[model samples]
Target chain A: MTNIIWGPMIVLYSFITGLVLGSYIISIAPTLFKMRNLEGISTFSMVTAWGFLLASPIPLVLELGSPLRAPNIYLYPTPSSVMALFGYIWIIFVLLLTTQIIIHSRYRDAAWFQRASTGISAIGLVISLIFGGYFGFIIGSMKAREVWSSTITPITTILSGITAGAALVALLAIITLRKDGLRKDALNSLGKLTLYFLAIYLVFTLIELSTTAYAETLTWTRLSILLIGYLALSFIGVQYILGGLIPIFMLATEKVRTSTIGSIVAFILILAGVYSYKWNLIIGGQQIVEVSPQLYSLLNFMPTQTEILATVGILSLSLFLYVLGLTIFPIPEFKSKR
Target chain B: MSKYLKLQEELPHIVGRYIDKKSAKPKWVMVVDLNRCVGCYACQVSCKMENGTPYEFFRTWVEVIERGKYPYLRRVFLPRLCNHCETPSCVPVCPVGATYKRDDGIVVIDYDRCIGCGYCIQACPYDARFRNPYTGTADKCDYCLHKIEEGEVPSCVINCMGGARIFGDINHPESIVSKMLAEKSVSVIKPETGNSPSVYYIGYEEAVKAGAPVTVINPKIGVVKEI
Candidate 1:
């Protein structure tokens, strides 16, 4: 194993793959909701699945493991294997979702399209929830890292995904809602949805910490590391207090809800909160050692510059891909028409 | 002349009875004599060089810890490796079944099959498994199987300045390890884990500290406690 080569490439691939998949969890809900108000939901689903298809699969091909002896996640998939389940879900759903969306969009006024869109969107939501929950459990299965071993991880990840998806949808709404001259009811309803997801985020965070206390699993050093070093506070700060609470508080009164710039600010803060929440979870969980006397570093564990650069590149690609999707997809046109 | 010839014929058969049973549940074991070990790190260097492990990934390494502060102090050199237990926790949880115990009681890792997901590294209670940053798969001491194939002791055992680590099959009564276990009171690390580890240490209490409490009261955290 010390052997021939295939170290740096694998590490980079793991990092890039993680970034893309982690971000996809956030994109699931909004794409589903874009059915009637924008394109049919199936249209969005096809594009979303295709977007992941474009983004997530490239890294897998670059993996260092022997091509001959490679795991049959794709070809001869084990039914119980999580990765295989996701792969199958993506292929089948994306195809069905895409076909239905295109068909429905062509007949936007038809009764069948409307009902089918709703049904497909609901199915997509379930799939996304599974995707979200599995992402966290993947890390939690690493029993060596006590930080990542918590049962609360799966819930937290799903909560984060839904809330972040809402934020993205809300951002798009700001651009679209303006042209539509959307009244208080639509804004209020959407704002309420965002606030509810934010509340879920808070509950998930609390549950994670509370479980740690009950188990006495987290070391004092690790607890302090999570609190002081990173944006553990910011996850709650921007996502809940400023992004969710303050926006809801202001919108409840009436006049502040009308301020376009204030809504934009809320969008920005929510975006920041969601991104940093994921960043903290990934980076902070890794900072602590899993075993006694440590494994990554007998001396000191630090990420190399190459690893950091590769992470930035993958992140940039994810954002770039999202923008690419928004630019090409017809949903933005619906916003313009509105 | 007839009696002598008969005895010679039976001697090979008697010895062959245990040795030929290589498939018959080989109970791999090691006995460490702390009374003989000085604080020298010869075993650590030899194991590292033999394994070609990257700096931190020690298949077998020695730790010299000082106890009883003051004018009177004692330092003990304890060499550690994968204990190769019968019920290793690291085995079952591996998603790929890359790390597993062979029929011969060896905890072997098939690097070819390892996905380098590092699940096994985290599950090991003894902190024995190391994920080679270079290879991405879990790397560990294999009890120097290559040396055993060559009919020689493991590098650490062969290079031991003090004859501390005695490696052999414990099932055979005539083996050095089996005889040592019979003669000396040997103990495995954290026996309560139910791993039934092969590695045994004599005079462990005298050489090592009365290890971090048995009951795990309050389950103290961040104190650099041994697992």
Candidate 2:
């Protein structure tokens, strides 16, 4: 068996990609779904999504041994490689997002712009969804990694993205706007939506675990590592308890769902939980001992200090971009009628 | 002509080997005789020396599986390396086309072209590939390409104490490997993966079917350690 190759940066990249997709999904509620309550944070979510989308590839590039040769993905793309599609997908997403944001911010009054923005927003939404699924496909296509080789992986990942994305919108709505922010009804609605996604995410997580339990092949070794081995703490504690149950209870209760502090706490847990899920999936899948005669032992694969710092640095830069975006873009007033 | 030293004038007849170009290119194959293996890992050591692989990594490794309890106990030495598969799973998964099959059927990675994304490493069912920490590229056993070019055996083949490692071109009708394949039963590892590995094992059915759990025996203390 080989030592662990992928580090924390890869995990961070997947989490950040989900955020990009999730934020875009939240932005869709107002523009495409035409939910009036969601209108308050539609522009905010779009800008945030763009910030995350732009930052998504930075971690990937940083993780590469030869970052300069990354363009080879486009230069000599193998048709069968799912990772090769990353270049084209990122470009398409950026272009559609740029057009959609411009139409919404600059020409909100023009009927033609509204129609165009709606169409463009729909396209952006589809791209974001596929972008979310693309992260899943990247790992799921690796048939050798038994823990990740399943069709349900894509579905579970998309659901997890939705949960995190909706929670981000709700958290931002509460924190930025405060008392004079979005209506009580809108906040509560967001709370309920986040809860539903979290529930479904939990179900998919169970299904993933259960399927692994029944496998008769060497894949069962991976399942044992996840459940009873070193990874059990992260899977059961951080993901299920801190991320899942606690947040579900918080959002399910009407009093907490309606309260700003309570909802923020819940959203924070949701984000932690979802990120932990990704951490477990990416890192855990790779940590399994390859079939070796010396009795393959799992490595204590932790990211280096440099890798940790780089991850934090990229996230900080992404946040900085989001803050800069909020300043430059004149996002419509929260819940204000046009 | 200008009183220059001519080294050619000093040396006598040292006839070089003549390889026929008219014959078809030889398709290389390795046959591991499981019955002869002693699980000493001499080949593993020689391979690392030949390749200069990192400390934590291996170009070829030995798996010594211990099966059953006390009275019925048995051990199997399973030396593993890159299958050099015909339909290698790692080939297409490489985003930059760094990994490809040669005309002679060896699966090789071009270090110059590999971006070190480690995709092919994960795609391999045998866990034969690795991201070399020093080079930052995907690496695996290429059946000792340098030695093959020199018309010599692989380092592992030369080092095997039990004479379990056999390397030859299976395409040649007169080759020992071709004779063994025709006369004896052999099997490849993880054939269900559909990788069609070129490496075959003689008398491997029992060990392969056992799927026994193994433990590491600390070389110094000779203590069996559980992981």
Full-model lDDT for every candidate: 0.57, 0.80
User: Poorest 10 consecutive residues of model 2 chain B by lDDT?
Assistant: B13-22
Residue pairs that clash (backbone atoms under 3 angstroms), model 1: A35-A41, A43-A101, A144-B122
Candidate 1 lDDT by residue in tens digits, A1-338: 11212233333333333323333333333444452233222233234433443454444434423334345345444444444465565566456545544554456667686577666656755665565566566556555456677888877776766665555545555664466554445454445555666677767876887787578777665666555544446545654566556655654544544466766666566656655555556555655553232212111234568655755665466556655654565542345453
Model 1 docking category:
incorrect
True contacts kept of 2: 0.58
lDDT for each residue of candidate 2 in A29-60, tens digit (9 for 90 to 100): 87788777777777888888888888989999
Off by over 4 Å in 2: A217-224, A290-296, A334-338, B1-23, B211-227
TM-score of 2: 0.90
**Chain B structural similarity (TM-score) per candidate:** 0.80, 0.84
Which candidate has the highest lDDT of all? 2
